[model samples]
Structure formats: structure tokens, C-alpha cells
Target: MNYILSIMPSLFAGAKMTLILFFWTLITAIPLGIIVSLGLLSYFKPLRLVLKFYIWIMRGTPLLLQLIFIFYGLPIVGIIFQRYDAALFAFILNYTAYFAEIFRGGFQSIPIGQYESARVLRLNYWQTLTHIIIPQVSKIVIPSIGNEVINLVKDTSLVYVIGLGELLRAGNVATARDVTLIPLVIVGIIYLLMTGIASFLLKKIERNFAKWK
Candidate 1:
């Protein structure tokens, strides 16, 4: 217990970085995903094909590889990014592809009649989307989005690959230095607590959306 307490500050600092990555990725990626999904659904065949290829590349590759490529490989081509920026850029691009697919699925699941009705009522494209389509799509994709968000929590640890010490990395350093697994155990517990809170909040959001059904 004393050992755990001794390392709490370091672990907390690492966890703060992890949360920063997670929150900022969510803020940026969700909207990017939406825009990508809209592009995928666009009438322009060339644009749709390009976006589709982008999504395929992102989704098909390992995120760790992507992280390394963005951070290390890009510098070879004269594109340099700081470690944090590299991690964030890779995470947002990778997760945006995933979220784009999820949102695309949600958009397709909507009945055609709703769109026709919106058209008949003379709702402009933006109004129809904001007032009708988006609400229903949000409700439908909540569970999938929540799952992705939880995965994002875990994935933040990958930032350590670029030497940006996040929670798991901090624990790893402590374990190596102290020659004990206690720090790792503590880190796991903290992760569980964070995920538990996220799950609970997601359930609340789900319930609120359920009222719309």
C-alpha cells in the first residue's frame, strides 16, 4: 500500500497525459468522422472513391505501424511532427476511419421514407440533416460509438511507443526500476476505474437517447 501511494503522483501525471490524448482525439475525430462519412455518401463518385480508399488504408493498417510511420517515416519526407502531435494525428486519423464507418452504417439504416418526408416538407439539406437525420443517427450509433470510446481509452497507451510517457509507460518505468509488479497493478486499477466511469456515463447517454425511441 505504501509503495502504491509512493508512486501515485507519477502515475497520476501519466494518466493526465493519457486523458489529454483521449479527450482531444475524441473532440477532433468525431467531427472529422462525420465529414468523412458524408463524403463517402456524396454523389461525386471520384470523391467517394478517394475517401473510401483513405478509410480502407486507415482501417486496414495497424495503428502502431501508422503511429511509427507518421512520427518517424514522415520526417524522412520532410514532414516533422512532435511526439504528441504525431500520436494525436495518428489516433485521430485511425479512429476517424472507424467512426466514419460506424456513422455511415447508422446513416444507411435510416428508412428512406424519412428522407422523402423531409424533402416533401421542403426542409433544406442542412435543416433536414440537423433536425431529423442527425438525431436518429446519434441515437442509433451511441452503443458503437461508446465501444470505440472505451477502446480509445486503452489505445492511448500506444502513445508510449513514441516516448510520450502515458499511464502504462509510467507504470512500466516504475516496474523496471523497482523490480516489482505493484505499479503495473496500480495502473491497471486506475484504468479500470476510468473505464468504469466512462461506461456509466455512456449508459446514461444511451438512456437519454432511448427516450427518443
Candidate 2:
């Protein structure tokens, strides 16, 4: 109990870093993913092929390797980043690919007849997307996006591979110092709390969108 109390500050600090990574990654990745999805669906064959290959590479590789490459490999080529920056960069890029694919799937799932109907109603491309396409895609993608959000929470721990002092790293430090697993147990609880809150919020959003169905 005393040891747990003693380690609380470090654990909290580490958790703060973890949250920072998670939020920024999600905030930035979603918009970038949307753009990538657009590129994937574009009429330009070269652009579509390139975007598809990029998504394939990102999804095929482990994020840890991507983090290592961004943090270490980039420095070798004279493009250096701070630890946090490198981790954030890798995370956003990696998750953007995943989210782009998710969004693309959602977009494709919409029937062609919907677009035809929108055209018959004289809606411009932007209006059609804003009024008809996006709402439906949002509904289709919410559950998948929720799962990805939860995965992002766990994936933040991988930042430790790059020597960033995120939540799992804090637990590891305490465990090594005290030779006990209590810190790890506490860290697990913290993760569960974080994911639980996210799940609750996502469920509410899902419910709100459910009205559209």
C-alpha cells in the first residue's frame, strides 16, 4: 500500500503523457484519414493506386516498427524529432491508414443508387456528400471507429519502445525498482478506467446516430 502510494505521482505523470498521445493522434488522424479515403476513392488512377499502396504498407507493418523507424531511422537521414514528436508522428500516420481504410469501407458500403437519387434531386457533389453521404457513413463507421479508439489507448503503451515514459513504462520502472507486480496491476486498472470512459462516451454517440437509422 505504501509503495503504491509512493509511485502514484510517477504513474499519473506517465498516464498524462499517454492521454496526450491518444488525444492528439485521434484528433489529427481522423481528418487525415478522411482525406486519404477521398484519395482512395478518387477517379485518378495513379492517385488511387498510390494511396492504396500506402495504406497497405501501413496496415501490413507493426506500429512498433514504424515508431522505431520514425524515431531512430529518421535521425540517421538527418531528420530528427523529439521523443514525443516522433511517437506522435508515427501514431498519427499509422492510425490514419487504418482509419482511412475504415472510412473507405463505410463510404463504399453506401449504395450507388443513393448517389443517383441525390443527383436526381439536383444536389451538388458537396451538398450530396454533406447531406446524404457523410451522415450514413458516420453511422456505418461508428462501431469500427470506437474499436480503433480503444486500440489506440492500448497502442500508446508501444511508445515505451522508443524510450518515451508513457503509462506502461512507468509501471515497468516501478516493477523493476520494487521487484513487485503491484505497479503493473495498478496500471492495468488505469487503462481499464480510460477505456471504460471512452466506451461509455462512444455508446452515447452511437445512440445519437442511431436515430438516423
Candidate 3:
């Protein structure tokens, strides 16, 4: 018990860093994804091409490689970010591409008749999107979005590569110092709890959306 208590501070601090990365990335990614998805669907041919290429690049690359490139390689050309910032940037950029794809799929799933109906009702694009399209898309993509959110929780551990002392790193330190697997076990439990909480909240939101539908 005393050993566990003594280790709490380091673990908590690491968890805090992990949670911060997860929150900011999620907050930024989803909204930016919406814009990118709209670009994918745009009638402006050049814009669509550009967005498609951008999405392809982000989706094609491994996120760990992107993190390394952003943190290490970019400094060669004088683009530098702090370790945390680099991780956050990489996460947001990568997840935004994925979420954009998800949103694009949701947008495509909407029936063409709905758009024509909106036109018949004299609804402008913005009005149609805000009033009708968004609500349905929100519900349609909830499961996919929930999966990403849970993945983000686990992905936070990847920040350890950049020497940021996130949860898993903290556990590694304790395990190495104490020469016991208890710390690693605790770390796994923490991770499970984090994902479990995320799952619960996402399911509740999904149920609420189902009610709306």
C-alpha cells in the first residue's frame, strides 16, 4: 500500500499530460475535419484536389513517423516545436485526416433526395447543413467517432517516444526502479479505465443521438 501511494504522484502527473494531449487533439481535430470533409465535397475542382492530396498524405503515413518527422526532421529546415507541441501537432493533423474521412463518409451517406428537398424548400447551403444535414451526420458518424476517441486514449502513450513522461513512461520508470511488474500492471489498469470511461461517455452520447433520430 505504501509503495502504491508513493508512486501515485508520478503516475498522476503522467496521466495529466496524457489527458491534456488527448483533449486538445480531440477538440481541434473534429472541427478541422469538418472543414476538410467539406472541401472534399466542394465543387471547386482545385480545392478538392488539394484536400484529397493532403488527406492522402496524412492517411498514408504512420502517425509515429509523422511525430518523429515533426519533432526531429522539421528542425533541419528551421521549423521547430517543443516536444509536447510536436506531439500535439502530429496527433491533431493525423486524426483530422481520419475524422475528415469519417465525416466525408457520413456526408456521402445522406440521400441525394434530401439535398434536393432542401433546395425545393429554398434552403441555402449553410441553412441546409446547419438545420438538416449536420443533425443526421452527427448521428450517422457517432460510432466511428467513438472508435477514434478510444483510439486516441491509447495513442497518447506513443508520446513516450519523444521523451515526454506520459503514463506508460511513468510506469516504465517505476518498474525499472523497483524491479517489479506491479507498476506495469497498474499502468495497464489505468489505460483500461481511461478507455472504459471514454467508451461509456461515447455510448451515452450515441444513445442520446439515437433518441433524437
Candidate 4:
């Protein structure tokens, strides 16, 4: 018990970094995704094509490669981000593509008649979106978004590849030094707790949205 207690400080520090990356990535990515998804649905052929290409690149490639490219490869082209910045940028960009597709599907699922009805009600574009469209989309995309949010909890570990210490990295370091997997077991438990809490919150959000249906 004392041995485990001794490692808590380092482990908590690593977990703090992981949580920061997870949160800022989502806060930035979700709005960017809403924008990108709208771009994907835009009438302009050029804009659609460009955004499509961007989405294809982001979604088709592994995030680890994206991280390496943004941090390590971009320096060749005069673009450089600090380690944490690179991780945040890559995660936001990658997850934006996914969330864009999810939002696009949600937007498309909303019937056209509703728009016409909103029009008949003299609701302007912003009004319709605010009062009607967004609420429905919020409900529709919750499950998919929940999945990604949970994945982000695990994905935080990937930042270690860029030499940013996170929970997994801290655990690995302690394991190597102590010649035991105890640290790893602790890391696994922390991850499980994080995901479990996320899942519970998502369920609550889903239930709240279900009232709309």
C-alpha cells in the first residue's frame, strides 16, 4: 500500500496532463466540426471539394501519424508547434473530421419539411437553427459523440509518442524502474474510472435529450 501511495503524485500529475489534452481537444473540435459539416453540405462545389479532401485526409490516416506529421514533419515546411500544442492541434483536427461526419449525418437526418415549416412560422435562419435544428441535432448526435468522447479518454495516452508524459507513460516509467506491473494496473484502473464517469454522464445527456423525442 505504501508503494502504491508513493507513486500517486507522479501518476496524478500525468493524469492531469491527459485530462487537459482530452478537454481542450473536444471544446475546440466540436465547434470546428459543426463548421466543417456545414461546409461539407454547402452548395459551392469548390468549398465542398476542399472540405471533402480535408476530411478524407484527416479521417483516412491514423492519428499517431497525424501527430508525428504535425509535430515532427511540419518543421520541414516552416511550421512548428510545441509538443503539447502539436498533440492538441492534431487531436482537434482529427476528431473534427469524425465529429463533422457525425454532425453531417445528424443534419441530414432532420427532415426538409421542418425547414419549410420553420419558414412558414416566419422563423429566420438563425432562429430556426437555434430553436429547432440544433436541439434535434444535439439529440441525434449524442450517442456517436459519446463514443468519441470515451475514445478520447484512451487516446490521451497517444500523446506519449510525442514525448509528452501522460498516465500511460508515467505508469510505464514506474514499471520499468520497479520491475513490476503495479503501476500499469493502477493506470488501467484510472482509465476505467474516467471512462465509467464519462459513460454515466453521456447516459444522462441521452436521457435528457430523449424528452425531445
Tens digits of lDDT, candidate 1, 1-213: 888889999999999999999999999999999889999999999999999999999999899999999999999999999999999999999999999999999999999999999999999999999999999999999999999999999999988889998999999999999999899999999999989999999999999988767
lDDT tens readout by residue for model 4, 1-213: 999999999999999999999999999999999989988988999999998999999989999999999999999999989999999999999999999999999999999999999999999988998899989998999999999999999998999999998999999999999999899999999999999999999999899987657
The TM-score values for the models, in the order shown, are: 0.98, 0.96, 0.97, 0.98
Error of 4 at 189 (Å): 0.4
Best by lDDT: 2
Least lDDT summed over 10 consecutive residues: which range in candidate 4?
204-213
lDDT value for model 1 = 0.94
> Which residue pairs show backbone clashes in model 2?
none
Q: In each prediction, how many residue pairs overlap at the backbone (N, C-alpha, C within less than 3 A)?
A: 0, 0, 0, 0
Error of 1 at 201 (Å): 0.8
Q: Regarding TM-score, does 3 or 4 come out ahead? A: 4
Q: What TM-score does candidate 2 reach?
A: 0.96
lDDT of each: 0.94, 0.95, 0.94, 0.94
Q: Candidate 4, after superposition: displacement of residue 126 in Å? A: 1.2
Q: Per-residue lDDT of 1-213 in model 2, one digit per residue for the tens?
A: 788899999999999999999999999999899889989999999999999898988999999999999999999999999999999999999999999999999999999999999999999999999889988998999999999999999999999999999999999999999999999999999999999999999999999997766
Under the 3 Å rule for N, CA and C atoms, how many clashes does model 1 have? 0
Report lDDT (Cα) of residue 210, candidate 3: 77
Question: Against the hidden true structure, what lDDT does model 4 obtain?
Answer: 0.94
